[model samples]
Target: MGFFDRNIFIDIIEWLPENDDLIVYKYDRHDNEIKNGAQLIVRESQVAVIIEQGQFADVFYPGTHTLSTENIPLLSDLRGWKHGFDSPFVTEVYYINTKFITDLGWGTPNEIMLRDADFGIVRISAYGSYHVKVNDPVTFLKEVSGVEDAFTTEMLDEKLMPFVLSNFTDTLGEAKVPALDLAMKYKEIGDECEVLLQTKFDQFGIEIANFIVENISLPESVQEAIDQRASMGAIGNMNTYQQYQMGNAMGNVGEGNSEGGSVNSTINDAMQMGMNMGMASNMINQMMGMQRNAQAPQNQQAPPPVPSGPGAPPPVPGAAPSQLSFHISSNGSQYGPYTLDQLKQYVAEGRVNKDTMVWREGMPAWAPMGTHTETASLFGGMATPPPPPPPM
Candidate 1:
């Protein structure tokens, strides 16, 4: 085909004969133009322009376009003629929906479903879908694999699947519980995975829509340990909290007691009683001091002796005869002085020894002077006293 005879109008249906075939179009080649009744595959980069011929028009598939002075059928020459061609260029866009899967050991699937636990002992499952659309067939063929191999199961499982799983597991491990505990922390883990993978997969021209962690599984042993720890912590916290509450209650009670009248009365009574006890203690101390002073020994000068009367006889000489006195036995008797020597002589002569009573005229009752010895001549009695006269 000549440069001027090149057909520019291309139909997509005519160029692509096979379902999975890729066509390439170029704008500088003459043979790349479509011929009458001949099928051709076009490159995606080829640019075409419309042409008209006498009573006929032709559509050129994407391919090389040539221009020359030679009188040949070209797309610019066809004004009214109708033609059909197929598109050689196809553009596809790919979007990736990533999900994370964790590893749950022996009873992975069952435990994930049953307890719905999230821990290091468990595994996570990450799931994702690959969405693809044709964009530029030529560039896509040069840059990437064929369309059939674009979204192959093996490619997805190999390239992106491991990334999804690793990202998800790491994110789940780093996920923190919510402050309010209103929602599962896995949702936050999913969000973290989305952010991380978005940056990692940017070069692949793949847009990651969503990354999610469907389930997390825990081992039975880990679950049991967690339960035990929770129980112990709860009990300990309850005991400590109860003690604190009781202390607060007691403090409040004490405060109330002080605020009421009872404590006031008790305090007042204590103050008054203390004052009274203080006064009594002071009085007792004063009295003890006075008693001690009164009982203390006194130091006084001796008194002067009294002088003897003139009528009193002088004391006897060295022998000092005994001073004795007696009464008379007769009625209306008068007594006299008796000397001790005289009395002793009378007693020696058996005049008087016992059974004798004497009375004086001034005496009120008879006096029994048993076994008397007169030392003076005061009494002349050696007989018993007589009875008194009867009353009138």
Candidate 2:
């Protein structure tokens, strides 16, 4: 075709990207004819690029401009026609949208490998939304749009998702925040990720206006591990936790049994805890007793053990009464053969009461405190009245 035949006239030129477009149609026309006086319209948040022979000839911002030799000297010069051509000329016109596009979704394609404080190395998935806009339309067209007929949000999505994911992974790895804590630091993580992305986005003539992290997640197994760790911390003691698990298992067994389930397991756990508590109490008592004994007068002799047989000798008249020891029966159980001093302490602490049955070496049978002369001193304080006698 002749050079003149190749010319096509464009009397009116204008382009507005669709509401969803990110980098919209690069130009209204691709290397088409433009009449010298054609009206070119540019809208807000938009720029129009004019290309001649694959080279940028001119750029127009928002507003109306008449396409003429005076306004497009670069095109005229490129054509080597100083006087300007009377006939229509060929040029490529591209319109770039610079408005912020919000709510573009992004997510990691595969699990991101990261180190967790509690779980060591773990894999996690993250997803969220972001907003982007063309900050430099010229560079955007040259680098992002390239030869594409139209650069769309969808295209941008396809192109930018990898950057988003890879950058996010890198930022997360650098932050070293555990997966379990990501929820609490979502905004912080997102902010750091946004900062990392901004530099790269600037190179592409795009800006990330806002970034959001909707959620960060862990695999089921990892989550379960977290839950177990949490449970252990909450329980606060390994032995107690073992007992708790055993108790739960025992409870489940009871639930499964149609016949009368034994209370034995529950009793066993309670008894075990009680025994541990008693052992601790006994150790404390021993220590305190040792300290008291050490501080006692050096000349005072240690008390002799009470005689055990029927022919045992009587207490010496001059010596202080032998420290009497008695066995306690409480709540249908035998507790201790505690010394009178220990029993007095127990009474003061309300651990032992008048209603509690008592037995001693010389006692004919188990009897209540009010009936025992040797133990009556335990409740002699001028306080609340004595408890009623135990049932016969």
Candidate number with greatest lDDT? 2
User: Per-residue CA lDDT of candidate 2, range 172-289, in tens?
Assistant: 8888886777789999989988999999999889999668999898999888766755654564543334333433332322232335555455435545665675464355345323
Writing each residue's lDDT as its tens digit, candidate 1 over 260-374 gives 5343343344345545544643553453231222322234211112223343333233534453333323222222233345445434544333433443222334444442323
Which parts of model 1 are misplaced by more than 4 Å? 1-154, 173-183, 229-392
Q: Candidate 1, residue 216: CA error in Å? A: 1.2
**Model 2 spans > 4 angstroms off:** 1-8, 26-32, 229-392
- TM-score, candidate number 2: 0.62
Best by the TM-score measure: 2
Candidate 2, residue 292: Cα displacement in angstroms equals 30
lDDT of each: 0.36, 0.69
